[model samples]
Target: MIDQILEEIRRYETIIIHRHVRPDPDALGSQGGLASLIRDNFPGKRVYIVGEETEDLRFLVRMDEIADSAYAGALVIVCDTANQERVSDSRYSCGARIIKIDHHPLVDSYGEPQWVETSASSTSEMITSIYRNHPELVLTGQAARLLFAGIVGDTGRFQFSNVTEETFLSAAELMKKPFDRQKFFDTLYQRKLAVVRLNGYVLQHFTLTDEGVGFIKLPLDLIHSFHLQSSDASTLVNCFSTTEGLKAWVLFSEEEGLIRARIRSKGPEINQLAARYHGGGHPLASGATVYSWDEADGLIADLKVLCSRT
Candidate 1:
C-alpha cells in the first residue's frame, strides 16, 4: 500500500494537501509533515498544504510553503478529512487527480484510489506508516516534531481505546528524529486556570443517562459569563470522560456564530448519531454542527435515544 501511494506521489508535479476544517495539531501535522516530505524528496515538485486556520500549529516547518495560485495540473492529497463537506478547502478538486489517504471510515464522497484504514488510531499514524516504507523521503527534525505532536494529540497520549500496537510502533519510529517530546506533551496536556474552571462547570452541570452516556449544553450567555474563550471549550468532553462510569460523553457549546458539538465514546459507536446531522467521524469519536442552540438540543435528544439502546 505504501509503495502504491509513493508511486501515486511520483506521478504529479504539483501536490496540494488538505485536512478537516477547524484542524487540531494532528490534522495540521499530517498535512505539514507529508508536504515537507514530498518537497524534501521531490525537490523540483511544488507541494502545498491547504486548510482552514490551524490552532497553535501555525509555526510548522513548511507553514509558509503553500502557493496562492492553483496548479495547472496537480494531485491533491487529502488527509484526516472524513467527508468532503468537512474538507477545509473546496478548491482541492480543481486538480487533475485526487488521492485520499485517511484513517476515517469510508465515506461516499472519497473517490476511487482511496486508501482508508478505519482501525488506525489517527491520520498521523497512517502518515507515519506511509513514510516508514519510503526511507528515501527526508523526514527532518522539525517535520518529525510536527508528526509526533499530531500522533499524540489524536491518540490522547495513547490512553484512548482507539489506540493499538501499531499506534505505539509508529510513534516509536517517529521518536528516531530529534523531536522535543517534553515540550510537545506540555503544550497538549497543560491547561490554564480558566480552562480548568470551564471544564468544571461543564461536568458539574452535565446530565448523564442510566446507560452512562453524558451530555452538557452550555449556552452562549453562560460561556461568556465564565469568560471562557472558544479555545477553553476546545475539548470540554475530555472532562466528562473522567466522570466515573462514563461510557460516552458529548459537549454542545453555543458560540456567537455557530452551534458546535463534540462526541466521544468508549463502549459503543456514535458516528451514526453525528452523521444524522450531516457530519462524520470515527466510530468512537465524531462531531456535528447545527445552526442554532435549539437544533443542537434536538440532536442531543436524538443521540440520547440511540445511546439508550447501546
Candidate 2:
C-alpha cells in the first residue's frame, strides 16, 4: 500500500490534501505532514493543504486558499478522515484521482488506493512511516513537529491505549529533528483565561450517572456566557474525565443550531453509537451530532445503557 501511494504521489503535479472538519491536532497534523513530505521530496509538485482553520491550532499550520481551477487534474489525498461526510472540503471530489490515508476504522470507503490502518496510533504516525520506509523522502523539522503533535493529540500525550511500539519508535524518530519541542508543547496547550473559567463551570455542572456515564451539555448561550466559543467548550470534555466510576463520557456543545458530540470512553465502544447519530471515529474516542436537546438526552440515555452493560 505504501509503494502504491508513493507511486501515485510521484505521478501527480498538483496535490491537494484534506482532513476532517472541526480541525483537531491529528487531523491537521496528518494533512499538513503529508503535504510537507510531498513538497520536500517532490519540489516540482505544487502541494496545497485545505481545511477550515481553527484559531487555537492555527499556530501549527495554516490553510491555503486555492481556486477551483487548482483542483483540475489534481491528486487529492485526505488524511485522518474516516468518511466523506466529515471531510472538511467538498472540493475533494474535484481531483482527477483520490487517495485516503487514515488511522480510523473504515466507515466510508471513497478513495482509490485507500490506506486505512486502524491499529496505527494516528494518521500522522502512518505519514511518518511513509518517510521511514522511503529513504529518498526527507523529513523536515516542520514535518516532524506536525507529525509529533498529531501523535500526541490523538494518544492523549501517549497516555491512551493506542500507543504501541511503532508509535514510540515513530516518536523517537521525529525527536531527532531540530524543531523547538518546548515551544510546540507550550503553544499547543496555551488556553485562554475564559476557557479555564469555563472548565471550572463544567466541573461543577456536568452530570454523572450511576451507570458510570458522565456528560456535559453546553448550550450556545451558556458557552457565550463564559465568553468562549463552542470550540473552547469542547476542549473541556476531558476536564472531568478523572471522576470515579466514569466508564464513558460525552460533551455535547451547541454550535450553529446543532449539538456537536465529543464522546470518549474508558471501557465501552462508542463509535457505533456515534455512527447512529451522524458521526463515527475510534471506539474509545468518537464524535457525533444531535439536532435537539431531546435528541441529546436520547444519546445520553443510550450511553448510560451502554455503560450499564459494560
* lDDT, each prediction: 0.78, 0.93
Q: For residues 6-86, write the lDDT of model 2, one tens digit per residue.
A: 999999999999999888999999999999999998899999999899889999999999999999999999999888988
Worst 10 residues of 1 by lDDT: 59-68
Clash totals for all candidate models:
0, 0
Per-candidate TM-score against the hidden true structure: 0.91, 0.98
Off by over 4 Å in 2: none
Candidate 1, 1-310: lDDT as tens digits: 7787788889888888888788887888888888877887889987887766744555543344355466568888888887787778788778888778788888765754788888888778888887787776688877788787788888888898778999888888889998788877777677667777887788679988776878888777888787876555866678768777777778887777887788888867888878887676888888877778788777767766766777
Q: In candidate 1, how many Å is residue 104 off?
A: 0.7
Candidate 1, superposed: residue stretches over 4 Å from native: 59-62, 65-68, 292-294
Q: In model 2, which residue pairs have backbone atoms overlapping below 3 Å?
A: none
Worst 10-residue lDDT window, candidate 2:
227-236
